[model samples]
Target: MLFPYLLKVSLLLGVLTLGYRWMVQFETYSKFNRLLLWLNVLAAWSLPLIPLPNWGPTRIQAEFHQSIPKIAQAAPAVKHKIAAYNPAPTVVSHQRLSSLNQKLKSLHVMQWLLVVYISGVLVLASHFFYQVGGLVWVLLRSPKEKSDRRVVFVRNLRSNSPYSFFQWIIVNPEKHQPGELQHIIAHETEHALQWHSLDLLLAELQRIVLWFNPFAWFHQKLVQANLEYLADRAVLDGGFERKQYQYSLLNAILCTTEVPLTTSFAQSLLKNRIKMMNKKPSHYLAWGKYALLLAVLYVSSAFVAPYTLTLVKLPPSILRPALKTLATNDKVNFKEVSSKILSLGPSKAESLIEELKKKTPETTKAIQPSRSKWVIKKNDALFWVISPLATLDDINEIRNEVKSFDAELNINSIEYDPLQSFIARITVHVNVKSGSSSTAKEGTDRYSPMKGESGYLTKSGSLGTGSVPNELEKQLQMDYEKALALSKKNEPYYFETRLMEKITALGSSSSHAFDKNTLNGAAAESAFRYDGVGKSTDNFLKLEPEHRNSELYLNSKPATFTELNSLSFDLVRSIKIIRDARGKKYMIVYTN
Candidate 1:
């Protein structure tokens, strides 16, 4: 799931980068464009974490709504009746067990992926620190001169010494002619005085974290290019000879070294800088473009993010081999499946039941924080979320508790044949101050990997958004549905939806799913880069970091990572990465 979240962030970078190229890349407003690029990066990283505004969409997919019609050859568990259910017997849910098994297996793959990602991060991080340490070492050993508030480090380097980091301007005065040295000192002084090194450092960190994202690399280049443009402009404005400065730039490039965290006097962006220097200044009025860009990004991000709505759900399909012995016509022992099971000791279970009940139509209210008018009224129906692992005794305790709390609680939500459900689930979704990749401002902290990739926890029961009063309900539903339709096109395809639901449709398939244990803060998602540690059976190889929007070959044929997920890894005989004379690598997977 973290993979999906990071994927969203990277995609945002791609989108915003394209937008910048089209709207502002060629613009001559250095300061405005600088701000624009910063916004682009910040928005891409933070938008996914922000909660949707109240006016944004609030479409609640019926957690238990029948998205697919009943499948052909309905399984027996689908018809088990409640009134005649027998107790003290096992009524195992094949779908539930299958889903659990998938999580257990995928956890291993997730761990391996974490290892790969951490390794990349460490390697890049070490290199970054080493460069920084080198700068410190050189500064300490070299003599320094103070000009105004800036410290200049005069070092003996044949090339690449004229660079600035923070307030420190480093130079090799012996290599440049008097005029050229003047231009170099002025240019690097602009970098130091303006604290341009901070920008480079920030960009470098982003590159390190998202080392695999091509856009991250490109964005860093954009940032450096702009800074150089500004610096060249400064040198010219300071009355330095433009021709001599241009000449000095060309000469300095001969000995330039690529230091990611410093702004050197000469850069590969030479052509772009010269062109920008000569280009007419963008009309001051052009500053308004940033305002327009921001408005558009905010509107798009708000509407584009999926609204997190809680609704009870059932598994709609079985993507893999299921357990044999399903609960057929066994009489569901009503006494065991209820709202309370105290024998497990004081637990979060009762509160979960209460949450589910409160989210029903009659009790539901507008999702606060959002605090909008989304309420469902007078819907007194039976709603329960049963745990698959509950024993027959647990069910009896729940039945007794429900009767004691309110004799008519399950009057409508509970369907008879639905009685013997292995999991009598009544989950409450508390709208806390957390945020996530999904919609809404509450719960699912973007940084909390333990909440699952979706950042959904104790989910199922809608919070506060019950029946909007009278006509308010109808209007809210109508407006929210429109927003929901648009979001469906963009929302990530969370593979776990299938596992979260036990009441599945016939013949449904799911992608690989992971357990919460493997997805932690420091790891999970985007860790698998070019073959991390993984498991391979004789038939198929379960690849981590698969589904990376790339193409691979299955037995010399084109196959998507998604298609590979449903494939049994036990059938994969080998996975090969091969290249032709062109050097374009192709992965060919052979199945046994």
Candidate 2:
């Protein structure tokens, strides 16, 4: 949110700064300068109201809902088990749980607050856009005659010259000036052709969206000045002399007629036009420099923007040294400290002393240190495994191979339920000894008879009946068949080799050493089935290839744990490899 807002501000500021520099260098003004200035101001004021989606709040909502199941499953199971054994736990343990609950509640409140803020900002932005749109529409519809022939006043003040939108021009046909009418027509035509009215309206709109930003106002001014420049170029291209053009511009500025929005000849700021006429065209290199400056400005704005507000709390132990250093400084007034200490009664003084002692170095050493280590007391540990087959029967041979390790290995659980029309997931839980557990990380190297020798080779292809036309369906079927054949020939071999490498690596890295002193009952709690993803059985089923065969899968395939194991050597080891800041790594082993 901050990034987008800053970008808008920088863009507006850059435009204004560049425009002012150009104006100073040119020593002249365009006909619509005053109107452009006013429009720019309006745009700046309305900028905050411009409608923009609040992606932050939306993302928070999604993440919260996704994590809810995991939290509910983990929290309740531990709470129940603890309560069953003892109605109330120690004060320390109870306090920790209470703190966790408070944190969760705070997170929920923050999520809602974000949602409300986003909603309000969006509503305000929409209203601002609507107001600007209305103003532009009214201006565009105003009554103005294009070419009026009256019987009265006809004065030839100057020759044909270019004028920006809403700039008034003096025309006299009675004097019979050469090409005077043609030049006037051409100048006005240029304004209409360039849609200068719409440009002004947009500039004004931008100003309103960023009214608080001075840069927004500047940007509008720059755009108006450019409009004038473009119009001048058009007039020059139409074969008007620079001297004659200057005279015409002067005459137009001298005329004091306010033209309607519908009228092409609307004279605005005459002084600025006179100044602009005397200036030379800008160089191309200036634009390149401006572009570079814009890039730097954007990067700086992004870097300086405030993002997260989560600050790490410094423990009192870390602050004690700093406090002691400050107290020792001669500049620190002893009188203030003496007065404050005297103000406290004997009882209060004792309480303060006690509080300080609790935060003191000796007290910190006596208190229990953070549990940063775990020990493998038992050889048996739980491990979650996923397989491509729907049932244990399909991988009975592979399971036997895994059990051949010297330690006792037990199958904790297995599931082969269809989640969707054709999709299904096969989840298996196994308990293995700490030493044997290392094999879980090793990539699978099993070769079944059903495995495709030619990888993902396909025998047939067809365009299933749907909304597609016959010709399009035929073309799609041909493409599908080609893809299937390629996959059949190449995919199986690639997956087999990759899986073998990963499994072997994991088996080699198995660790048996564990720190028993740091182990906590809470840390050993098992996560629920739906804790990670969700309780959407259909979603799980649809993810499997067997289930997907029933439907025309449109979305791209997601990489599963199996695929990740094959690709990343480090990831093949385990789901998590716990390590402390001191670089000591610990492997967790679960017992069923």
Candidate 2 at 478: error in angstroms? 38
- Per-residue accuracy of model 1 over 287-384 as CA lDDT, tens digit each: 57666676667655743353333322321011001111122325532223221221222123324433443343332442222111221122322222
Report the alpha-carbon TM-score of model 1 versus the true structure: 0.49
Cα deviation at 514, candidate 1, in Å, is: 57
Q: What is the Cα-based lDDT of residue 418 in candidate 1?
A: 24
- Which number leads on lDDT? 1
TM-score of each: 0.49, 0.31
Clashing residue pair totals per candidate (backbone < 3 A): 54, 49
CA lDDT, every prediction? 0.53, 0.37
Candidate 2 backbone overlaps, count = 49
Q: On a 0 to 1 TM-score scale, where does candidate 2 land against the true structure?
A: 0.31
